[model samples]
Target: MSDFSATGYQPVSVSDPEVAALVGQDLPEDAFREIRDILFTVKGFDLDSYKDRCIKRRIAARIRQLGFPHISGYVACLAAEPTEQLALLEALTIHVSQFFRNPTTFMVLEKKILPALLRTRPAGRELRLWSAGCAMGEEPYSLALLCDELCNSPEQITIYATDISNDILKKARQGRYEPHRVAEVPDSVLKRYFTLEEGFYRLNDRLRKRVRFFHNDILNDRPFHRVDLILCRNMLIYFSPPQQEHILKTFAAALVAGGYLVLGRSETMISETRELFECVNAAERIYRKKADDVKEDD
Candidate 1:
């Protein structure tokens, strides 16, 4: 029901049952193979093991609005042109992000975790953090603000924020925000960190320079550098269980021994991989990597 249409795309109609029926139709095994090819060619997302039903539901909603009822037609649309593929990929890859999305979790980071990380860091060392799936850059900027408040020189901290969407990454690097996006940001921090211009907020140079933005696919690529904390946030919810497990193992590999992993409020480690990470702040979904674990992929 949320307005999800992003640049040059129409919003999919959300009359529940109609959307359900279109998705409920039986899809051939070959249908997914075709889908994986189109997705990879167009958006570079490999959807081979991605849960078909969940994808079909999203596809059906888009198809219904576009007046196509059959999955074949949807595939045709994807094959017809590159633009359609871009639009479909934008819709398929979920981009629901907000400033300081989980306040309690952020509070724990600001009040406790960061201070502890700073204390144990070797002399004159800088902290490195990665905001995986950092859609539109709010989370990394928020971390920059926190680092500014916590560290004597915020420039000492470095945050790498990445997302698969080239479109979102462009917007993120611009560092501009709609006014409403800052609703949860504290007034003191807001005024200190951003300058208002033309009905939007622009992140100041200090905070902006501390964060670097890049394109990363968690499932396919190596994480950047050793990190003190990695904030993957809400992205795990959309992936299939096996995909989730694959990514978590990558996350564990990316972190230094005893480094932190943060997830969205609704996500948890798959039961099978519990031994790889131990919870630190259970309610905030904060975890620390197991010192004894080694990557099988390595």
Candidate 2:
């Protein structure tokens, strides 16, 4: 059985080089297309937007779960076990978010990035923020609490929190959470922004009111443009280099010059997009958008 503790199913390291190499290594071309087509046409799930390695390994995991021998078998099995396709998608999305994840990163945002952004904003001008890949609402709510503490008027700050899953977005809209999910939250933040209900902590509407939750697919969906800082932490690891580059371009296009881009601690900008953003705090994965002298290519 998989490790299912407080963390739920503990996935085996998908980052292992050897494991990564196994992705799409032996799959037949026709079979691969069959699986992708089934996911797209029948299941209404688009696999092309995601990297092949990500799709293949996650599909392989589901194949193991169902005792299927290969992609061909898995594709056939999907007809009989329709729910299996959903199981594959749930596996692929990879939600590991928690409140105040990576304390050092948030510390940098609070002390450096937010301060700089505030200083630049004209008085009464709204400071905008977007939390991409905001899973179950912990990250966005954490940002909300931080804004409450840092901003002179929390109402002046507007936050957009987006995730790809409608199921996940529904839970985010509720703003309710279990204790273990909030274990990393500070006592002060908890006392101020949350109301304890039974055993779980319910985030106050005051905090929730500041943020707008919605569903967005980072790859193909229309990216939010203009404004200020964007936090896309721990999300690029699931994408291919090309996908990562496309995402970086999207972020660059979205942020105003001098606006900040905060990525996951493990993620970084490649040489291909170095000119897009200047590194502000390398260790904290904070980058400031470099002024675009030329109009961005469509």
TM-score of each: 0.79, 0.76
In the range 130-211, model 2's lDDT, one tens digit per residue, is 9999988888888888888898788888899998777788988888888888999989878877899988899998888888
lDDT of each: 0.79, 0.77
Cα deviation of 94, candidate 2, in Å: 1.3
Q: Over the stretch 86-154, how does candidate 1's per-residue lDDT look in tens digits?
A: 777777787667788888889999999899999998888888899999998999988888888888976
Top lDDT prediction, candidate number: 1
Candidate 2 at 109: error in angstroms? 1.1
Q: Worst ten-residue run, lDDT, model 1?
A: 2-11
Residue pairs with colliding backbones in model 2 are none
Question: What lDDT does candidate 2 reach at residue 208?
Answer: 83
